[model samples]
Target chain A: MQISTEELPGGVTRVRLDGRMDIAGAQSVDLKMNIVAGSAHRLLIDLEKVEFLGSMGLRSIVIPARAVHSRGGKVVLFAPTPMVESVLKTSGIDALLPVHHSLDAAIAALE
Target chain B: MLGLLAASMPEALSAWPDPRLTLTSQLEDLALVLPWLQALADRYALTASTRFAIQLCLEEALSNIVRHGYRGRANQSITVECAPSPAGELVFTIEDHAPPFDPLAPSAADAAPTPQSIDELQPGGQGIRLMRRFSSRIAWEPTPSGNRLTLAFPLAR
Candidate 1:
């Protein structure tokens, strides 16, 4: 898994995550993402390239999202593949961290 | 031209071999089985939904054995068998030499009402819930040494 972040004009940060979010992949990114989500005011994660999403992957997202929420920040997921999207929906993580199909919608949601 | 190329291609390329994996009941071993599972999914041409279900179920079962069943023990064998059944369904059997644990048995918490809010969400147990939701048929049998869990998944239409 690969995680790269870009700072938007505002305090929003766009984090692009590619590859499977399986057990190994989640471990690679969880610590870094938690730190990122902890500091950012608004965070957007792009899951367009993520090929798989498992329970551990859900933990990676949920933990960081909760951290951000606790700090009065917001975190959103965008463009998850169909498979990943279904996993998110089935696991009920979508209720806590909203998912969007487009960048505009994700940014707007964070607003 | 396309037809001629197709006919010339080797049958080995078209045929899918069944994927079987054996790993020890260690959390790190979870990584080793992933590629084999992916090969099984690719071989059978599993749809997105089916693949997701299989992965989730396997992770839940394997992780449970590693985390709770074995409980710091090492060198325990966890065998996994996945193949297409004669009846056209995907069958997966996981055998582990840990203490007998029946994931299908409903817990006391199962009878409780669903949480109305996320804050009230339980800390654990979601894995077993997901496995039950995804597998079409699930059965458990106690082996001489440990337990065996069998799961059948339907093909995507």
Candidate 2:
């Protein structure tokens, strides 16, 4: 999986994730987050292009959500695909986490 | 800390503190863990609706790990981890050292069941499909050793 990281306004880092996010898919994301761990104020992961999100993928998101939040920052998920939407909903993240429908919409919320 | 336990524990497949009893790793162990996993959900004293979903998810997931992950390799080892979340939730994890495989890939068909019992609907690859639908959170990580799969469920209220 390839995850593109872009610096966005309002101190938010926009991550454009593409490809399958699963068991073999977590290493890169974990590495990416570790690189930007303390440098940014927030991270908005763009899931629009992500073709798949599985249990392991959800954990990847949750770990970052907890890790970033603990540092007094936050991680926002943007535009998850339908496959991811059900997982988020069943996991209750759809209601608990901040998920946006578009990157622009997500960036706007950070401001 | 976890490695210490694995190293010191006696080799017992059906008993406690056995890190080797993963559902995906060994098909025979499925019966060992399935009943207990179900019993935990039952002990939750949850409403029927929630209990059914939980049971379905747990059973199917364990089955998937056994049938899909291990791929019938002899002497396979799948690690199943169940821990309690700080929020009083049950977090069940299954990991295995097999060839790289992702069971959650979306199938070509995206249609609803033709009205069968949720359990009987047996949505083909739906065990995992429902696991993602039923659990609070599911995550995976590939270690140098194997694939680490974790499923978290909120305790019944």
Judged by DockQ, which candidate is best?
1
- For residues A7-84, write the lDDT of model 1, one tens digit per residue: 986678998899978778998999889889878879998899998877778778777776777788888899998778
- The sequence of per-residue lDDT tens digits that candidate 2 reaches over residues A1-111 is 887788865778877788756445665687775666556668887888876565556666766665665677766788886656755665545554578886677777666
Ten-residue stretch with the least lDDT total in model 2 chain B: B114-123
* Per-candidate fnat, comma-separated: 0.20, 0.02
Best by lDDT: 1
Candidate 1 at A89: error in angstroms? 1.4
Q: Model 2: per-residue lDDT, tens digit, B36-124?
A: 65555555555544544554455556556556666666567766666667887777777667766555444412333332321222214
DockQ of each candidate's interface versus the true one?
Answer: 0.33, 0.02
